[model samples]
Target chain A: MAMERHERFSLPKVWKPRNVGEAWSLKRSFGSDAEYVAGGTLLRTWWEGEVAERPAHLIDIRSLPLLAGIRIAEEGGTGIGACTTLAEIRRSCGLAAEYPALPEAVLQIGAYSIRNVGTIGGNVASGIGDALPALLVYDAELLWFDGSEERIAISEWLERPEDCRRDRGKLLMQVRLPDRANAVETPTGGGNAPFSVYRKVGRREAFTPSVATVAISAGRTEDGRLERVRIAAGGGAAVPHRLYAAESLLEGKTPDPDLLPLIHEAVEETFRPKGDVFAGEEYRKRTAANLVAAELWKLSAGRQGKE
Target chain B: MIDNRTELAPAQSRLTLRVNGAACEIAAPPSTRLLQVIREFIGLTGTKRSCEIGRCGACMVLVDGEPVNACLAMAYQVQGAEITTIEGIASGTELHPVQRAFLEEGGFQCGYCTPGMVLSVKALLDRSPDPSDEEVEEALSGNLCRCTGYGGIRRAVRRAIELGR
Candidate 1:
C-alpha cells in the first residue's frame, strides 16, 4: 500500500523561468500543482494566513514576452498583455487617450512599487478592487491560455460567487479590450464625444484599498439629450458588475437638475453593499449613488457646453 | 552543538547583470529576490528594503531602463538584464542630474525613500525627458516618503527634467 504524505505548513517550492514559453512548459509539467506568480503580492498575503492554501509550486511568469505590453490591436481596441504591470498601463500613451478610466483606476491601485510589480493578469484574476470596475466599464475580455487550450470572453471567465468557491483552476492569461467605438460610441448623433471619469471612495488618498469605486462614461446628442452611458462599480458588491439598470435609465434622458434623484435611485437599486472595517453599507450606498449623479451631471454639462 | 565549520555550498544560479556600465556575475538561488542578492551577496546597500512586499517602493531598481521593485523580482529574472541602483547613478565623484536636483531641492529628510524616488525620477526622465507635474506625481506615486518630502521631490524631478534637457 502506498502512503499519502501531507506535509503541514511547508513553503511551496518556487520555480523562476526566463520567459513565457518556459513558464508554459512548467505549467504543463506541474499541471494543477503549480500556480503562476507574477508579482507575488497576493501570494504572500495567502502565505501569512490572510487567505487559503498556497499552491505547492510557484511558477514565476514575469519574463514572458507575450505578457508585457499595452498596444493598439490591429482591429482597433487596446491589447494589454497579461503580465503588463499596472505602472506600465498607467504610463501607456494609447491607453491613456482611448481608455482614460483605466489609467485612472490603475493609478489608484496601490503605492508606486506595487504598481511596478503587480501585473494586469494578477489584478483581473484576483477579481477584487479597481480592476473589476475599470475593465467592466471598458467592456474588457479575459484571454485564458489553459495548458491545452485558449479561451476569451468578458462574461464567461468570472463565476457568480457560488460556482467560483466550488473550484478554482482557471488561469487568466490576457485582457482584450473592445474597440473604442464599441466602448464609448453613442446611439444618437454625437456632438462632442464623452469622456470617462473614475471615482473611488477610499480610506486614504494612497496605499489604502477602495471602499467603493465607480467608472462612468456619458455621451450626449447634438440636441442635449443623452446618447449613451455606461456605468460600472465595485468594492461594495459581492462581485463587481455593470449597473445595467442605471445605464438604461440614463441613456436618452436630459440631465436637468431634477434628474439627479432618479439617477441616484437607479444606481441604488444596482448594489446592496455590506458593512466592513473601511465603510458601512449605508455610507457606501449613499456615496455610490451621489458619485453617479455628480459624474453624470458633470458629463452632461460638459457635453451641453461643447454642443 | 554540531560542528559549525561545515562549509555551506553556495547556491549557484548564474546572474548576468550590466550594472553601472560594468558587467558582473553572481551565483545565487533562483528564488533569491534581486534585492536580497544585491544587498547581501553583491554588497550594494544603496537600495533599501522596506515592507519587502511590493506596497513600498523602497527597494526600487532600474531593470532594463524601467523602474521595478527589486523585492518582487527574482535574481534569475534579471540575467542578461541592465540594472542600475542608486550607487550607479553618478560618474566618479560627480552626481547625476537627478541626484543634484535632490540635493539642491532638499528632496530627503529621513532619507529612507530617496533611492527609490531617485530611480523613479530617472526612469521618468529617461522616457519623457520633460514630464508634466501630474506625470511626475504619477511616476513617483509608488514611492512613499515618510518625512512628507513630496514638495521637494516634485521640485527635484522638475529640476532634473530641465537639467537633462
Candidate 2:
C-alpha cells in the first residue's frame, strides 16, 4: 500500500486545549515545536509552500468558548471572536452591510470551501491576509490573552517589530470593530459623509495571491473637503501599514483629480512592498499607487458631475 | 524513516464521525487528515484528492451542510461533525439531479474532476436552488476542471436549477 512507504515528515501530535490559558501554556511548553490551530487552513498553506516549518504539535483552540461567535452591540459596532470562520462573517448580513469591504475581501480571499475552514483571526495574525488592508481602514482593534487579557489597536500591534512578537505567546481573543466602521456611503451627503474602498489586484480574477492591495476611507465636509482620510497597502508578503504620507495629502482637502498625481507619488514613496516570482517590487508599488489614485479620481469625478 | 513506528505510535486517537448518515468509529493517529480517514479508513473514494492544501477543492465535502476542504481539515478536528461526501450525495440508488444534470450536459471529459464538481454543484443547488451565473462561477472557483472548459459545467448547473425547481 502507498501508506506502507516510509514517510520522512511524521504527522504532528494534536492537543485539544479547553481554554485560552491551556492553549497558551501548551505553546509555552512546546516552544517552536507547537502551533495554536483554529481552522489551520492558513498554517497548511504556509507549511506546504515552505514558508514555515511544520510544528511537531498542534494545539486545537477551536473548542474554546472564549474564542467563539460574533456579538453585535445593541448600541452599535460588533465584536467578532477570533475563531469565527470567513464564511461565518460573509453570511453575517449585518456585518457585511456595516463593513462592506471586509466581507468583499473575505469573499475574494478564496472559494467557498477555503472560507469555510479559514478563520479571520488566523488571517489577521498571519500578517499577510488580504483582510488586513480593509480592517486597517476600519480602525480595528484586537483583544489578546497573553497571561491576562490585553486590548490593543491593530495598527499599533502591526507597527511592533515582528521579531519581538514571534515568541510573545499571545493568543488573539477577539477583534473589535468600532461603531465608526459603518461610515460607508450615507445618503445624507453632508459634512462627515464617508466613502470607503478596498482594491486587491491579484494574478487572476479569483483564487490567486495578491499582486498589490490597497484600502482607503475618508469623509467629506459640507464643502467636500476630505476628513479622517485613511489609506493602507498590503497583501501577498507585504506587511500592511497605513500610507500616512498619501493620506495627509488628501486629508482636509477636496479629492480633486489634479491632486491624484501627487498622492500617487506619495504612495510610491511610502509603501515598500515585497516581490515574488509572480510580481516585482516596482510593479506592486506602481499597482498599489495606481489603484488608490484611480479610486480617488473616481470620487473626485463623481463630485465634478454634481458641480 | 529508520524510526517510523516510534514516531507514529504515540499520536494515535479514536474518532467517531457521522458520515453519509452512518456513524463511523475510526481508531487512527491524531495526525491523520479527514480526507485520509474518509478514503482510506471508510473506503469512500468519491471525494477526490488533488491538492492536499486548501487551494484545490477536489477534496470538497459538506461538513454540517457547509462546503469544506476535506484535505485541509484534520480527522481529530472534525470528529463530532456530520460529514457528507460525494458518495452520500445521492438519495440512495437513484442518481441525484446534480449527477444527472452533469451526465446529460457532459460536464466532464477526463472524469477525474467530476466527483468534486458534482459535489460543489450540489452544494450550490442545495443552498440557493436558483443561483445566478456569477454565484455559480464563484462557488465552482475552488474546484478546478481541466476539461469541458467550464461551459458544460455552467450548463449543468443551470439544468440542475431547473430540475430542482
Candidate 3:
C-alpha cells in the first residue's frame, strides 16, 4: 500500500485596490508582507504550489491610477505606466509611430494572452531576457516605488544579478523613454530612418525564450558621422549590460563595410557570454556581434542612401 | 529525515467574477488559476489549458476587453474585471464575424486552438478596426494551432477584416 500524505496549502490573501492612493496605502500597510500583482502572469507561476516559499499576501495593482496608461513625457519621451499591458502598448498608434522599436518588441513577447496580462512593469521587474535589453537601447529609465519613497533611473534600480539574489521588496513602477533619443526628424525616402532595431535569435519563431537578444539604437549626423549609438545584449550573462566598448568605437566613425568587422570585434571584447540549454557560449557571442553589426549596417545604409 | 509534521491549514476562499456579463461566485483557493475557475468550477469548457505556463496561448480569454491567458491569471484577480470566454462569442444565434470567417475559411480542423485564436482575432479587430496583413499575423502569433497550419487562419482574419469593413 502507498502512504498517503494529506498536503494542505492555502492561497495568499488578496487585496484589490481601486486607486493609486489605495494601492500606496496597501503597499505601506503590507510592507514586505505583500507583493504587487499587476498582470499576475509572473506572480501566478511563482506561487503555483511548486515553490516551498511564497508571499503571504498579493496586492492587485491593476486598478491603481498611478500605474496605468501610456503618456508622452514633457521631455518629448514616452512614459509607460507600470501596469500597462504589452497588448495595450502594441495597439497604441501614438506609441507605434513615435517609438516603432517599442511596439516591435511588444509584438514579439510571449503570445496574445500573455501580452494581455503581462505588464511593462512586470517585464521590467522580472529583468529577464529581452525586456531590459530593448529598453536599455532606448536609454530607458525605470521608476521604482518602495513602501516609503519613489526613486528613478536605470542605474539606480538595476541589480548586478548578485544583488538581485540578496534582496527583495523593490517594485518597478514605470519605464520612461526619451523621444529625442532615437527619433528621426527627416525621413529617408525608403521609409523613416531606421533608428533602432531589436533582434532575438531563438530556437523557434514564436513563444520561445530568446537564446540571445540584441537591441541597438543609433543616429547619423547630417555631416555623415555616427552621432550616437546605444547597444545592449542579454540572455548570455549574469545580467544584461551596455556594450560600452562597442558603443564607444562606433560613436564618431561612419559604419562602412570595413567598419563592420571592427564593430563585430568590439562587441566580442565587451561581454563574455556564457552558454545555457538554449545555445552555446560561442554561438551567442558570435551572434551578438553579428546582430549589432547587422543593425549598424542597416542604420548606416538607411542614412547613406537616404532613400 | 525530513520532518513532515507541520500542520497545513485547510483552504477557504470565495472568488466572485463577472463572466459574460453575469456575476458568478465560486469557492476556491486563493491560488486557483482563472483558467481552472472558468473550465472546472463554472463549467465553461471553451477555454483550453495547455502548457499551464503562460507560453502556449490555448487558455486565452478577454478580460475587460483585453485578451489574456487564463492559465497565468489568478481567479481572484478577476473580481471586478469583465471576462468573455469562447462560449460568449456568439450573440444569441448570430455568429461573431471572426467565428464566421474561421468556418468559411477552414481556419480550424482539430479546433483545440480555435477558441483562443478566435478570441485573439476579436481583440485585434476590436482595437484595429482594420489591420494590415502583418498586423494580423503579429496579433495571432501568440495562439498556436498546429492543425490548420495558420495559413487558413491568416486567410480567415483577412476575410473577417473584409466582412468587418
- The TM-score values for the models, in the order shown, are 0.82, 0.92, 0.83
Candidate 1's error at A10, in angstroms?
Answer: 7.1
What's the lDDT for candidate 1?
A: 0.72
Tens digits of per-residue lDDT, candidate 2, A204-301, equal 88888899999898767778898888899997888899999999999899988889999999999999899988888999999999999998888887
lDDT by residue for model 1 (B1-165), tens: 122212222224677788767898886655567887788878999999886666668999998888888877766667788989999989889999999999898998988999999999998888888788777877887788879558888888878887898
Ranking by TM-score: 2, 3, 1
Cα lDDT of model 3 by residue, A134-169, tens digit? 787777887665554465555344545543431355
Ranking by lDDT: 2, 3, 1
Across B52-99, the per-residue lDDT of candidate 3 in tens digits comes to: 666667888999988888877776667667999999979999999999
Cα-based RMSD of candidate 2: 4.5
Docking class of 3: acceptable
The per-residue C-alpha lDDT of model 3 at residue A155 equals: 39
Clashing pairs in 1: A112-B142
